[model samples]
Target: MKKMKWALLMVVVLVLAACSTEQPGSKSSSDNEDAGKDGDKEFKIGLSVSTLNNPFFVTLSEGAKEQAKESGAKIIVVDAQDDASKQASDVEDLIQQGVDLLIINPTDSEAVVSAVESANNSNIPVITVDRSAEGGEVVSHIASDNKAGGVLAGEYLLELLGENAKVAELEGIAGSSAARDRGEGFNEAVDGKVDIVAKQTANFNRAEGLTVMENILQANPEITGVFAHNDEMALGALEAIQSAGKDIVVIGFDATDDAVKSVKDGKLAATIAQKPEEIGKKAMEAAVAVLNGEDVDADIPVDLELIKE
Candidate 1:
């Protein structure tokens, strides 16, 4: 009788342990893990933007937000402030929130590999915008053909200034695909035709562009034209040119509103126009498509236009 009583106690304890181990508010994996699989349920998209300091990226975010509103989907935007580690951390937090899909604009291509891997592990599809990642499974990359735009700038500069004209280059941020590809295409187009007297990096910043261009002009005052990777740097170069009282033709990329106005005012010579809003909208749509299990291309190139007065 004592042995039976002890057995009963042991059984009760075991049952209590089992009950305590059960997760609180737990549901079946099938119900929670695949909520948006059929395209009927609302999707939650995670957007990781590199930085919002520039007006260009700010406009991109507005585009994404607009599309999300129209589709009745939820979007979470995280700013990395140009820090790779911060971006990775933001991505982890986004995954913990159970986002249905991810759209990443990496601060650095190689540095974002770990973040991409984490998303892959969580079984979430990734779509990169503006900049791309070196590793992980990216379903799609959406942006304009930066190299082609560079070629256009180079050809236009060549036409404006004779082949024998000397020129200086105001480069964009180092290690960015935009800077690398734009430089390559421009060099190829102007090969042996024009003299690149002074080429240096301005880090795709307006202040840096001003300082660097000023110094370059001091060394090679004969430079007749300039090719800046982006509009910010080009604007800086324009300011420096004006300060030096130099009649130099400056070409910029990414026709931001200010750049267009500058061109119209005869301050800046020309700029390349990229459909930034289109890129953002397409990226958001692609994330939705991935959630719905629809097909998508690896690379989607937006159209580019040359803006000049």
Candidate 2:
């Protein structure tokens, strides 16, 4: 009787141990499947931007994040700090990380082509924002009409000064498409009517704009108007004008909050507003469409508006 009782106890202990092992294993497998169903399966995207120092790009980043969260995709953002080589390296790292898509705001239009092409060869789609690559077949490009913004600035300046005023121009990055297009359009709109007294490249930086505008003021003190390619430069020019005790009319692009306030305070004349948020939202939406095997337009142009306080 004693031997039989011990055997029964041993059998019961072994059965309980076996049941415990199977239960945890089954639960773990189910948990892994749940992870996949919750869309946490490691879908990643790479976003390379020119700079995060600028408010415009900050807004763009926010918009992208909003859209990406809605689609359940993870985004890795890299700030190039306005350096082309750094941007290239960042993109390479993203490629190595096996990102599903690449979104770039090229610091230099032509410098980013090879990096984009590399991704293309690896079967990854590349999308451009604001700035474009010179010779690459990107999946999509989203931007505002920079040239039209410039033309609007030019026309507004001409109207303010009666089409025969002396004007100074503050240009952004020299080789950038935004700089070139805006300058060209402004020049065209005011062709043979207004005199462009000085045109200098401030590299789209505020401090540089202040120095450049000061030099222009010294060279041509009688200038009636100033046009800057971006709000940062425009604000700088405004400061220089105020410091020099000049009352020159100033107009800028990128209708940033500060720029709008300047206009309201009667310091700045007008500014063209580019919809950064809209650009960002649209880019993400386009990325989703591409992922879904749906066709998207090569160029998505966001509209611009001139804000005059």
Candidate 3:
């Protein structure tokens, strides 16, 4: 009987202890279970820009940073310095930082697509700003319509220089989406009306623009107008034209700070102004939306306008 009573007491004690040990309202357990259904991740974005060397890209970066500040989110920016290989390495580094999302302004659309694909393979959503990737699963692309801007520039150039005018074409980087689209639209607008005396790629650099424009001027002294893809190139072309003592009307894209001032000063005749800041902000916002698992448009185009003195 004593042994039976002892065994019964031990059973009751074990039952009480088990009941006490039950974690009915444990925060960690419930939190882990609800993580997928109810919780959001700590927001962090990776912005990989082609180059911070240009004021346009710098303004873009500032815009994205400002938007992130408003949302209390963090962004990690990497500058590729216009190097495609370096851009890919930078993307990998950002991935190692555990960035929740990625924004890429590609140096070269096709070259950057590899990095973009890697991000996609990792299940990280990518939003391209200003330049779209040639190949990748991009969540969204925020940019101005480059083709339309080019057409606008071409039409305006025709109005300024007139039909049967000799013009030199200053192209941007080869294999870039911007260059391709702009060239396509410009060609469509001016193929029959304008005579392209010299078409050369300056790689969208100011110094190169000067050198290339000099060569084109040397070859075609009859060139009456210059069409540069960007302002930096246009400024360089302006310098070259002034040096040659030629009265050539210069039109450029990207109404950057220098370009705007130049336009005001009547140096550069006109430039197509794309809202780069708005593009940056919209891109960052799109990334946030994607992180939250909300639906977003695949293409989000910003507005463009012509800026003239």
Task: Find the candidate with the highest TM-score and give its number.
Answer: 2
Candidate 2 lDDT over 1-309, as tens digits, reads 999999999999999898875654355555555232154453578889888988888899889988888877778999999888999999999999999899998888888998999899899999999888887779899999889999999999998998779999999886678898899999999999999989999888888889999999998999999999999999999999999998899999988888899999999999999988888889988987787689999999999999997
Q: Which ten residues in a row are the worst by lDDT in model 3?
A: 33-42
lDDT of each: 0.89, 0.89, 0.89
Candidate 1 lDDT: 0.89
lDDT of 3 at 127: 91
Clashing pairs in 1: none
Model 3, range 1-309, lDDT digits (tens) per residue?
Answer: 999999999999999988785477656555554243235434889999998988889999999998887765678999999999999999999998988899999999999989999999888899998878999899899999999989989999999988999998899989889988888888889999999989999988899999999999889999988888888899999999999888889999989999999999988999999978988899888887888889999999889999987
Model 2 worst lDDT window (10 residues): 33-42
The residue pairs in collision within model 2 are none
Model 1 spans with C-alpha error above 4 angstroms: 1-39
TM match of model 2 to true structure: 0.88
Q: Please report, as a residue range, the 10-residue window in candidate 1 with the lowest summed lDDT.
A: 31-40
TM-score ranking, high to low: 2, 3, 1
Q: Higher lDDT: candidate 2 or 3?
A: 3
Query: What is the alpha-carbon lDDT for the whole of candidate 2?
Result: 0.89
Q: Write the per-residue lDDT of candidate 1 for residues 1-309, one digit (tens) a residue.
A: 999999999999999978785487866566655344344577999999987876678888889988887776789999998788899999999999999899998877888999999999999999998777889999999988989999999999999997989998888766677888889889989999999999999877888999999999999989999999989899999999999998999999989888999999998989999877888898988888777789999999999999998
What is candidate 3's TM-score against the reference? 0.87
Name every residue pair that clashes in candidate 3: none
